[model samples]
Target chain A: MSDDFERNLREHLHSEAEETREFPRRLRGRIRDGIAPRTRARMAPQLALAGALVLVAVAVLVVRNPHVIFTDVPSTIKSIFQQPTPSPTPQPFTCTDRSGGTTGASSQLSTIRTAPHDGYDRIVFEFSGQIPSYDLSRQDSATFVRDASGQPVTLDGSVGIKLVFRNTDAASGVQADAKPALISVKEIAQIGNFERVLSYGIGLASSQCVRVLELSGPARLVVDVATTASASTTAAPTPLPTQPAATDLGQFSCLDHSGGVDSGSAMQLTHVRVAHQAGFDRIVFEFAPQPGATAHLPAYTLSRQASAKFIKDPSGQPVTMRGSAGLRVVFHGASGATSYSESRDQTPNLPVVQEVAQLGDFEAVLSWGAGLSRASCLRTLELSNPTRLVIDVQTP
Target chain B: MLMDPTLGRVIERWRDGDRDAFEEVVDRYGLQLLRTARLILRDQALAEDAIQETFLKAWQRIGSLRDEDPGPWLTRIAMNESISTYRRRHRFQALTERFGRLGGGKVEVSTEARLDLAQALDRLTAEQRAAVALHYYQDLSVEDTARLLKVPVDTMKSRLKTALRRLRELTGSDEALA
Candidate 1:
């Protein structure tokens, strides 16, 4: 390594360090206000009594066993005084069960980092364990529903994003709610922590393009939302239909939007996500990579049918679902047999889309049927980076 | 180490419930701690926040201080707080790790001097940056840096060595090696 380079680094640090010379006025006042409580707590007699008892115990132990004084005194004293050090050994990582499975699988969310940049505001969530898988969706309104309590949480701002983090301990050292002091970001609050699923809601002044990414080297989930200036430039993964509901257009026909190049191995299906917006409901079929295979989506198709009946792929066994109408969704060259672990059948009974059932998971073809209340116009989108297929069903 | 009699007097008064007596120590070391935190965090506001937290912690434990000179103890707290803040904001906007290379991050360069070293230091990973800051700015020994960062001494040395290699490459000074 270059000595000049090291020299310059040292010089730069020292010179730059001189910029701030004094504590701010606010800090001094905070210190003055804080002194009283600490001083009072220090003067409490309980601690002195405890200290005396501990000394007496040590005396008796040493008298009873003199060899411990020579061999273990330093270690015993150190253990009592010092902070407990975390074990250096790492725990084996298993996928956090989506249905609120094992506590051993859950990781603590240690810190939340946020900032506003030229075109986007970023939020990075730091976790003690591996960065947990998450579900991200844009909501039509800032009205959030708490997970377990089913209480209504009205947040600030016009539009919002709802995030559900799976296998996270909600009891971690994080703020219950915060206004993230960013340029365009307005508010963020923990909606609930139910069964190891921790949910947070981010409210923004208006709708914006957003993206979520998983980063390693101290596992973090990065959420970036476009600011007003950069909204036009930041390309969304896929655009959702935001026009007024067109029940007049009537036909729930969908052109085949899900065919793609398949690699050596089929995509591994992971989680199934659902969200509700104004006039529409959406289901996201998210996938993770089968080892040695790239993260990708398979060829998929969505079609509307009159009856809530579907035949299992290859098996041809008909499965009946709820609702007056039905939607058949199929992904070719994909199988959920190995990767997908979440519940296969879901009964989320929303306004337009009521239930979803796994029609088949055989011979490299994974299929699901969406039970709809009525025939509705729907849209499909393909997104990457933890590849997902999005199906949005419009309400009549 | 011989205790400074004057510093001893100050510690005693502070232990006896004089608020300004502790604030006096803040006056002596506040700038240095801020500078150390600033080097690690790269954001002056966050550095100030770290220093404030350090001072508050020191205030709480000041009475039980085993020694007169509080420099090393205060620096240790500041290092922990700065590293904690750094882990949270590595790819943040106020000071990015020159994230343009990291795909989703952006770095804004203001001054020539800052651009030179900030870009070079940003090339180091968070662990490397902490190693360098503790070893260089806070003047901690490699063993102490390892102990504070909770790594083996050899690991600390490796991180510092890797950090220097990265800095050398960023500076285009590839002439020397050990």
Candidate 2:
């Protein structure tokens, strides 16, 4: 090529590069505009309704919403009850500590107590609850307990109570149920030093509500003695409030006990727990007061692109939503009392909250309910602190 | 129901007037927009401002967007705003030049032999310089260059050809060409 031609082309290209500057300007503008949120806020109610329905269906098909009460027995257990073993229906036996099969007699609720037994805090119950006389090999749990004392009876100094059923040989004719069992814990009265009622609004399956009746060291344990209810009748048992739906925003990791627990499903807040995950979100505000401290909100409210939601206390109390736009929730308590909030929508601030002084070293799931779908409990906090308030919100 | 199409529809509806739709939009795109702005602006604070402004403008003029291509449109607006900022500074430079006060000199191009070429380029009209930049560095077609500048196709070609001729004479590169 001629030198003049090559030089001319080079000059031409150089000029071209210069014009490209405008291209960047234009491209930049477009990119900027693209990032902006659309102004149209008009969703057709039908569309929303449709979306809600689709979400509901997806949730239903994906996994049962933990909140919705399923009248039918869970499919997992349906088949076991469907096929029966051939034979005459065995009479109910009342023998204790006997490993009987499908025909084992059901025991009635007898007496319940919490003593420092076996070197651990033991919430023992004498089962007189009705059950099949022979062993019902299929898995089923049938014991219930609660902190009827209004205050949560710490389980061997642990956050949760453990029910250990001992099948000591009872008098003759007293039968023992087999394999799977149900246990429930309900709080009834106030006891000990912990002020903010621990298990105030907790719900347990009627069947599981028999194991350890955590009374306020004084409530009565009325063992509802009845004939053995048919296996078919009790086959489809209801779950405790802790069960959550499939699509619920599963879990989060909060920094401390003050973390929030929430769900897009918008269900009633039942339980909450702090868990560990890859990253963090915001904290949650529990309406229930802290167990034993005067409620003083932390000094700083976290700010970020994410958000936080204030959930209702399991006891169904309204929590205070403070901060810039009701984003920060605060639950005022009586002097020297405490409350909790699971970190939902984010990983809550750990060291900031007052109660998380001790490294509780436990993660939990927070659950809630919505009109269309039951929200799944999520783990929104890392137990980066001790003495963390690990709430277990059950889906409604 | 499939949600992707419905999400688009929801956005369209939100643009219509349901006040709560604004929040939905914010919830849906807040992080995404923040990210886009950050990529474009580089400065975190500036990116935030850009995103905020982008949303503001979208809210204000969303009614104009009748087509489904909201993304490119929005991005264009943001780019224009940023460029407008650049233009303002450029205007200041022009003002300074009018007073015979030179602003910051251009970064000297790499090759000294190219220095004369660069100075010669400095001497060319801004339109000619832009044509060269787009054609050579940006690798745009003459047709695209014209469309971008809103000039005729032939005009772009002529400007390019003229720039080459000038460079050839200034550099005395006929021997190299042979």
Candidate 3:
């Protein structure tokens, strides 16, 4: 019966009688914007005149107070207007306080290890059940002591605290079933530039921090609060070496633009190194596996430009660029901080580059400029291979 | 704010002077608009007009829409406008017929076969009419039809089932419309 009913409806819908089912051409886009004729006709001239006035006003404002017009942008985009000047984190120093001093709190001072730098401060505390929110505003006696510069520093902004809770079985010491818990925070007070982080005690109630309500019960909670402040001249920082300005090397394909050939043939660049004296400041190369080639070039090396100069191998030896076989390029700093990585497969060709030719599977172009410091340049080129032909960046 | 990639995004883009986006929207749902309008007016030309007015109103007032789905919103507007036009035309015809009778002349009232179908339609209530329209013509499910009508699913189902039986008895057809 259902089948017959569906069949009948389909037949009725497709029959010649239903030829009128298609929407009228004249009413196509017109139907979506159902404006009344009288209002539309009347509003047209007035709207045009008003629009002209608005444009004129905008132009005049731009000519007079250009910054004001630009500043009128949404807050989300306006935040980007500030220059990214790196403000150093202040170093933490121990001091004896006359008030609010506690032996229990003093013992907990060694609980957290923070990054050593000026203008940095870190405090650690532990609690059971839900993590208690700290109210910095309540610390009215808080004051910043200057080193030698006699400059008084303030808490730069809001501090972020990491809350850690233990999860374990009570008797079995295994894992226990839990409930999803969430922490609700409210703004209690603001003192100085530091907004007090206030959290209501969850007590025995389940929190978002724990999966099992029972495990979250009587759990040891740890809170690590890190703060940053502007540097003071009292304590002189270490003198750094004078570095040269970075350069932007012009067009150069990381991978030969010519799609690589079969498994036997790999994309090869004989003499590739930093061309500093040249007009180009940076070298960007697009690479892809040879077309229809399953074979992979695990790595490649960049010899120094002086020895391997304009002829054979500039630096003499090749810096291995490898994924599975060998490491590619130079890796510096921490162990996880790799300066160079390889493409797992090929990234989808971008439409902009597709106009040139159907090239390899993916493309990677690295750029370095004269303004970029050595560390900054290395950090920028530090590619982390998360996917095929894809390298994501980790902010330092 | 995140980009509204669904109906809300389409409407937002249209509001932002992207007339081409409106055309894309039209291409996607034009037939559905006509079908929904036709259910009320039951006339192709008038349904097209209603559909046109519906889209026109949608373009103008789309900025005021806080919700995401434009389908139910557009359908409501189209249905209301079509019913308004139908009522106005019917009243005008009735008035003309009354004047003809006062002038001592027999009015030539041409009854359409569709009118007989309409009379059978009148057996059901107004809510039932909307339920039938949304279910069969608009091709909406019970839940969606309920959402469009601002009624509970069970209420909508009851209205539809009752409407179907009323229609069957009026037309004397045991065969279901589905």
Candidate 4:
């Protein structure tokens, strides 16, 4: 854009560049501070550069701290097994399990990781030896207190879960506040290390159902927070709200129960009604068939579900979440949009039914999901004369 | 630059994990690297940070350095660190600043005679600022500057030309820049 500077100006600028300056003050100290990890002195005079070319960035997480055999944990452990189906009995919200002491090379809390899964976000605390006795409980607020000094440690999200491991110590930088970018499990930070117990706080986007499990081989404490309600709601951690009282029929099965015939006018669903019955809550799926008084109800199936997402088979898409837990209801030889005039998704927020969602309607198979506050036992009934399928969910 | 007879042994000692010998390298080049970094970044504090990261990286990967003369290699590291810091800051704060440099020719340059040339260099992009500091202020040859920056000779010349033109427009010190 412009020609070269005049020769006289070029000479002047070159002279100005010759000005000398002193070295920056405290630069050596700053550089030393950056490499705060263990610095090995020349272990051998004839050590090769290849051997000395160790960058601590890779080992920083694992080798920061070392501990000997763990000791002084609770002797008795009540390690409860994970429930495969919704439990009729109430379970403790807090963990009281103890891991017996064992002699080992290192018994330190070495790594902390946070990840987001298909329907939940997982945070893992990995230890080098037998995992020490741990107590993990949900806190009402996100703020926490340091173990010994009692100073407050504030976290980022709204919900909090504090986990403490007795007779264990974490590496210095094992837990940083670098939470994963927008997820339910917000921040997992090591808030305190007093005496021999190591404490960590997990921040969440909202009140969530947290599942804790202990694994062997490397002995890691794995915690999973449901992205949506898996089996229990946060407010009713013990004795899920769906547990039936003595008057209702016993819940002997969490399996799918099916009935009704697939013949008669393709069963175009027309109206849906929900009500609280004597011993159960009812969802009625009424169909209009050929404007006739006599028609057979369509075949259908009902089962308890882990989540509302049906990524395979009929739904073929990610279904949205309504309540904490879900029940999937599938109907065969039925039409979803053929007769229904009202909205498919309903947020009734009833005592037993929090939401009624149309998960998918394809290939003459109709799928609907009921989002509930907690897992519940359900039974189905088929009625004739302008066919209807009634689902009665047993309630507390 | 020719290799200093003692500088070779100092680098060897550093590779052998001698902290003092590495500190000696910093004593030798810290001032020169500071000037280049300050001009490229135009921030006193960030230039210092660039030098700190430069030496830290040097310690971590010094075994890979292949030459006897540490000056050019050290300058290469410091220059790269400075440019990286410049890019990271602008990327997070002002992505549009890349296209709207020099106020997009909208805001008028100050009428008062400028006191700090570093302020005017900020109007140029990070690459232009680096090229100016290397070829003009640091007195490196065009080809040598291109080699240090890992850019083509024609690209380096283009940057120097466009950057010099804008420098004259802002500082009105054209006679000295050419």
Candidate 5:
């Protein structure tokens, strides 16, 4: 019976073999045409000899009468004899930090922002006062130092680095806070302060080449962590000698917004869907605005909470979700009249974003709980034309 | 294991730079190569393209032909080309689909007899499908298939067993086939 089954299976599988049985008449011709180029390429020595003869003839003529030879020779022959222009050698990237010999005034870090570019990500630390004297170093793991107590503070990710700023302090009164944004960067945290020096640990997805630049006008420190060494080609080269400008931000930067409180009326939430892409997993939130009123999606906070159950409704009740890492997405000026949710069990299984839950739509503020395999770099994008809020969480 | 003497001579002459001798090999192996590629890619146009590329590559590397019977060598090249083409096209389609430029389409089955088998094959991973094609359709031994796929013998066996079990389950679902 098994032999018969095998025979049947083979028969079924080979059923269409006959359709491709006859070799196309054009195939032999095409193969010959393809081989001809290589066959000719093999005769390069002979071709070069002939080209040299022509070049020698042109040289003799040009020496005899330079202006007459230009009128005499065909343009093609002239091009063949003319030397090929050498291509410009690309400059090797070098990291240069210009703090401009730090001002005596103490610096205050107000906000930290991250934006993803074609092949890299940029992290900007805006300061209120003088630019701080900083040291950027790659570490085996993201371990930070408390500037005030000399205690070790831990950050996320297996591999990362620390940025220690001397004579600097946090603008906010909080001692430490973790901010996770961009693709390669997992989180940025302010470890405790000690001895008037403020240290921050930058959690990276992996150890990558990082470049630091000190910008003035607003007195900010910019750190560009390359996703790949070859990523610089994806974006147009920015003319150096000047500070990295906001105009150099790629199209992906349009999704970036400062997390600020909003007063606009809420828009009705429509649908939510999860999709897995090559490098990251996406969670898209669809919204429909009230007629005759423009929908305004406020700058919302997206942070990794301690547990998936850490998210709560407006009435102050715990919301449950799947997975070990929880991402709480709070959208102000957004609400749903009728709530909708989906549980995505991906086939071939995505590395991150296991499950998503709609926590609440209470009081014109919509909130969602996303379950990730681990705490990772996350970015939010606001899209229009039927407004959508797209959140991408990177997977290692 | 004995190669046809005429085919052997043709291969030798092709290696000696007689371009016409290469056509003889093409006429002899083109259909078989296309069949093998179709088994992997499941697309006629893609199979044809793979075979054309295989022949061109074989022509260029004729000096490397060491096997007396070049059937397995040609089949291996065809399978590799087909898999690479499938992967490139799959990635392009996935990117286009993400941007909402393309829509999903059903696989076109050539005949009624192949409908069930084709559908069943589609459900298998690319590696599993390749294993089944090499072991069953091409009548290669598990060892030879493993070598062709650059996999360990035990891995190839496991893949074939899993594929056979899945195929049995699929065919068993149709009472008529069972």
Candidate 6:
């Protein structure tokens, strides 16, 4: 390589390096005080023995008198034990409108603010008057629609929470059209109607548990969404389920019954694509319309298989896929009348999914297999209109 | 390579257990280590981890290093750590696959220039990538680069030759290499 090439490469790499802000300062302190890795390795056995002893003691106590363990345990120990395992399950949060009807007086939504906390992000909607009675519900996608015009309102996240406030308007102290205050809350669409209800759609990065709180002085409605699975909490009295089994279907376990199957026409699988996201790898199947078709969404089953092999059409030969682990997705209500042209999409460098293959559309029970680098947490979403079946496998 | 007298004293003091001296070493070499690791690993967070582990190891074994200047030694450690991290992470993913579990930066360049270089760099093997990083970015001579990589000088020369050829092909910059 010439000196020019070397110099250019150096300049190129240097330009891409992130700004060296506090790294040197921060690393300097850590190096000064940090324990040596070898020392840590040397101490491992002793630490393991100590840990085992404590676990043994705790088990014996629980067997001897379980109630005593809970009652006499230190708060710190209790908190540690109570710290919820980060599961993708949505925690239940419900706040009913206490005010029977609109108070006849309208309140203006003044300012929107967002702040990040330890495990959650908060969005506060400040109002000029009394906090309005509202209804909030989670949706598969956060696109808010104008109730009057029925046009879809675009928001930032795949998942959303719709907030509808009664006898409120955005016209008073704030702009009628205002963007969301935070990245997680994609957009705050103001649906000001003459009747009484003022609605806003809150978009989120992904599905998260939302907690609604009402505060006074200058009245405000605050929503807190867990930024991470572990950060999720519920103000409701229901105790969470114990840690799920290793193979438990996490976020995909819940059934979204909102869009009923169109029973009239057969659904045609049109296109398939795969992409990697921040926390998961996604496979999308697009479905096309059949005239007078009432689409039926069959109860699909997702399972991991030992090998990435599928029985080929007509030949009866097994086709091997690119990954070590194979995910078989069988859509029950699909029509086999229109056979899909088999295609394989490869994403070799991704952490989870490696390849996605259209195994067979035999008998309209559309089946596809995804070759994953490893077994992963899998979730599915069925979107309507230009129907799409989305499967997201979370990277560990 | 020229040695900094001040950095040389700091290395001696660090070996003698002066914590402030270690800080000086970090201040001087931390960014360079980070840049080299980032080039090798192609991920900012992973690069940071490799550099951190490298420095920690350097601190632990500071007494054993007899070199008057610590730059090359530190760079070698950082390079090894980055490559190790890349392999270890991929190995963990492969292991988890058998059990059927799915688990799983900076530049001053114009965004486009940096992106073009990053994409081109991704095509090289890890050995080639490391050799280029140390030789070009760190300005180590071919002999020193070979020594740091623990390969023959001719082997280092071949690696650089192939890496630059591949990069030029990818970026369509034959003239730049010429």
- Against the native complex, each candidate's DockQ, computed on alpha carbons, is 0.18, 0.06, 0.12, 0.13, 0.18, 0.14
- lDDT of each residue in A335-385, candidate 1, tens digit only: 889777888889898997888989888667688998888766566667888
What's the fnat for candidate 2, on a 0 to 1 scale? 0.12
Sorted into a CAPRI-style docking class, model 3 comes out as: incorrect
Q: Give the per-residue lDDT of model 4 (tens digit) for A229-306.
A: 553343333222444453353332323466677664567888888787765678889886666634767777676665
> How many clashing pairs does model 6 include?
24
Candidate 4 deviant stretches above 4 angstroms: A1-20, A36-396, B92-94, B101-118, B173-178
Q: How do the residues B1-178 of candidate 3 rate in per-residue lDDT, one tens digit apiece?
A: 2323554555666788676566656655667667656655656777776777777777777777665656667777776777666666667655664686589755222322222345655444345666776776556788988887778899888887776655555554443433
Per-model TM values vs. the true structure = 0.34, 0.26, 0.31, 0.35, 0.38, 0.34
Whose TM-score is higher: candidate 4's or candidate 6's? 4
Which candidate model has the greater lDDT, 3 or 4?
4
Model 6, docking class:
incorrect
Is 1 or 3 the stronger prediction by DockQ?
Answer: 1
Most lDDT-accurate candidate: 1
Alpha-carbon local distance difference test for all models: 0.70, 0.36, 0.37, 0.67, 0.66, 0.66
Interface quality of candidate 2 as DockQ: 0.06
Instruction: Name the DockQ score for candidate 5.
Output: 0.18
Candidate 6 chain B superposition, TM-score: 0.78
Ranking by TM-score: 5, 4, 6, 1, 3, 2
- What docking class should model 5 receive? incorrect
Clashes of each: 1, 148, 64, 3, 4, 24
Show model 1 residue runs off by greater than 4 Å: A36-396, B90-115, B147-150, B175-178
On residues A1-396, what C-alpha lDDT tens digit does candidate 2 reach at each position?
235455455555444333321112222333333444434445566678989998888577547555442533366367677886443333232211112211222333344444322212223334444321211111011212343343323221101212212122233332222111223323221122121111112122222212112222222222211112232122122323322342254432111113333211111222233332222222333222244533332221121111122333222222222121122222111111122334333323332221111111111122221110122122322232232223322223
Predicted candidate 5 versus true structure: per-residue lDDT over A211-278, tens digit per residue: 66667767777777778746433221222221233223212210112343365456777788888775
**Which residue runs of candidate 5 sit more than 4 Å off their true CA positions?**
A1-4, A37-48, A62-396, B92-115, B171-178
Task: Give stretches of model 3 more than 4 Å off.
Answer: A1-18, A29-396, B1-8, B92-129, B151-155, B175-178
For model 2, the superposed segments whose C-alpha errors exceed 4 Å read A1-396, B1-4, B19-42, B88-106, B109-178
TM-score for candidate 6, please give it: 0.34
